[model samples]
Target: MRARFVSATPSEPAPPPRDGRQSAAALLVARGTRRLLRRLDFASVTELPLLSGRRADIVALSAGAELLIVEVKSSVADYRADHKWRDYRAHCDQLYFAVPASMPLDIMPQDAGLIVADAYGAAILREAPRHKVAPATRRAVVTRFAQAAAHRLHALSDPDAAGAEAF
Candidate 1:
């Protein structure tokens, strides 16, 4: 599927568009990525298939000859603890983690792909890395993920809707 996401830096307080304002880190990475991708000639799909999982966040896929998955992270703990992030590698031929530009990329695994982004653009810090995932408990995890994703998608598609009415 084509990912359809774009990141733009915020200029003024209460910017013209809500989407232009990204979290501090995302802003950095988005900016960083944009500058880097200038040399490449390819399109990117934004907010692509956001899988259902324990730590589901926005994912963007590269629109090109090859399949690429980019996972965006906003928190340090989430950076450390996103379980199904490992599973993402299974579905896609290429997988990567995207984060804010200023944050140190030192701690990230040397073999795992990385994207450093800021509000203006993004840059690929690392690429062509290896990821390890064990298959033992993935079935159960995927099942739970499917259910949660279905519910979350429903909520997003219908913002005015509410769950079973809190009483």
Candidate 2:
């Protein structure tokens, strides 16, 4: 995804559009993930680029340096269309599927963790089994996440820096 700066004032600027504005359900999932992860003391970055050329909906890092990736499915159609979610597991210690409470959880892959979310909050219905990532892989993911966050923050001030791609 590409971002363009739209400055409303010389001293203040709006954040770049995120994935060109997420779908309603996706927005809820993101907000809920933030809320939940915060309680667990996990810092998260959204729309994280992965090694497989796919973007994780949310990538979180815990105090112990454990990595978790969550893929948000907004609807039945969204869930059905994706087959690449498995690719996310290779990049993180644990993987999860996050969806609105109304979504049919039964259809989600049993091996992945499950999160039932609303616009306000989320609850982990199942814990994902950890498959520890190699140290080299962990370093790569952490570097990507850090660079993405830094670039976005820099864009907020220098706007022109928004052109730097995270991947």
- How many pairs collide in each candidate, listed in order? 27, 0
* Candidate 2: segments with Cα more than 4 A from true spot: 1-17, 162-167
Per TM-score, the best of the predicted structures is 2
lDDT for predicted candidate 2 compared with the true structure: 0.84
Off by over 4 Å in 1: 1-24, 27-39, 50-64, 130-167
Task: Please give the lDDT score at residue 119 for candidate 1.
Answer: 66
State the displacement of the C-alpha of residue 25, model 1, in Å, after optimal TM-score superposition. 3.3
User: Best candidate per lDDT, number?
Assistant: 2
Error of 2 at 96 (Å): 0.4
Least accurate 10 contiguous residues by lDDT in model 1: 12-21
